[model samples]
Target: MHIGKAIRMERIFNRDTERAIIVPLDHGTTVGPIAGLIDMRETLSHIAEGGANAVLMHKGLVPCGHRRSGPDIGLIVHLSASTTLSPFPNAKTLTGTVEDAIKLGADAVSVHVNIGDETERDMLRDLGRTASRAADWGMPVLAMVYARGPKIKDEYDPAVVAHCARVGMELGADVVKVPYTGDPETFARVTEGVCVPVVIAGGPKLDSVAGLLTMVRDSLAAGGRGLSIGRNIFQAARPYQLVRALRGIVHEGWSVEQALEGLEG
Candidate 1:
């Protein structure tokens, strides 16, 4: 690893735990200022207070979310995007570059690629190009890859998810994020097959906090590096407490039961 990339990786992944609790705050670009995201500074403050390792957002949001006064946190600039209003919403296009992230003082750069989507080839190309550029600058690349197309009956299938993760590694991502397969056994397969650190993506919001906690715990048990969750952490009734509880699990090795107990306390 390049010295610069290694240094940035430490910023995103806790030096002691070698894991991360990343909150993606770039949704405003895709879904239009949704709840929990309307106030970037406040939300970022809460996340930082809760001890999250890093936060991912688009280039435009850097000014708003990266505040002057707060506990420092890592910044990952997302390089790909497609609005929900677009006719081909699943087709993520490169809207920024690794150079853009460097100019913005980002610790890392991320790209989203939806496999099996009609524009999968283009997204893969973008990811490959971004990874190459990031390497030149010694910046880490986080790849959010998912199976979300007509042939995909289930995005969470262990086989499909593993394939998505492998694609990210093959293309040169330092970290890969994918939807968690329902259980640890299945999810382990996804993690075991990949060389890069694997993190779980928080898909849709769930009804029960315990359910979410359990999923996080299970992923950890299955050898996941950590989480790159957004809505579940940011949209929670208490985002700060939720992230603190997650830290206990991700960094402190708290079980789901222990995490829930801490969350309620």
Candidate 2:
């Protein structure tokens, strides 16, 4: 890795451990307005004040007043995107390049790849080429590897999840974001198989704060580094409180009830 890229990766890991929070605002490109994110600026501030270490957003959102306004939280530029209006939502096209990300002063770059879809081959090729370029440039690549296809029975399948993570590492991703397998023991296998750090993805919005916390606690206990929560934090009644609670669980290893009390009180 280049000196710059190595430093950037170290910075990302340090931020998450030091703060243990990531507020992902990249959902606008994939799911459109869900909730909480209706006003991006307010949501960003809430997360930042709540002690999030990084914010993942697209190129446009970053410069449009959402970039570093306060203490410099790490910025991760999302390079792949597939809007909801697209005919093939799983076919994530490369909207930006690592060179562009570097020019934009991004701390890291992320890509989305659907493992079992028909466009899987093309996406893998893109990942390989991009990974090579990123390595040359010393840019850290976060691969969001999801298993979705005709053969996929359960999105939470341990074997499939492990496969997705392994594929991302093999393609040269610095970190892999994958779904939780509902059990710590099973998810541990997936994390152990991957060469790089693996963070669990916060899937669709949950019904309750406890439910969200449970997942975070389980994933972390199972050997996962942390989380890339989106809707759970943003859509919560109190975004800052939810982020703080999550940080307690991730970095401090606090129980769900204890974390909730800390945030609520």
| Tens-place lDDT digits, model 1, residues 1-265 | 8999999999999999899999999889999989998888999999999999999999999998878897999999999999999999999999998889999999999999999998999999999999998999999999999999989999999999999999999999999999999999999999999999999999998989999888888999999999999998899999999999999999998988898999999
Clashes per prediction?
A: 0, 0
lDDT of 2: 0.83
Write model 2 residue lDDT over 2-110, tens digit each, in one string. Answer: 7988788766665446323566788888887778767777888888777677778889887653644755667789888897788888898888999888988888899
Q: Candidate 1 at 86: error in angstroms? A: 0.9
Candidate 2: where is the Cα deviation over 4 Å?
15-20, 67-69
In model 2, how large is the Cα lDDT of residue 121? Answer: 91
Model 2: lowest-lDDT 10 consecutive positions: 14-23
lDDT of each prediction vs. the true structure? 0.94, 0.83
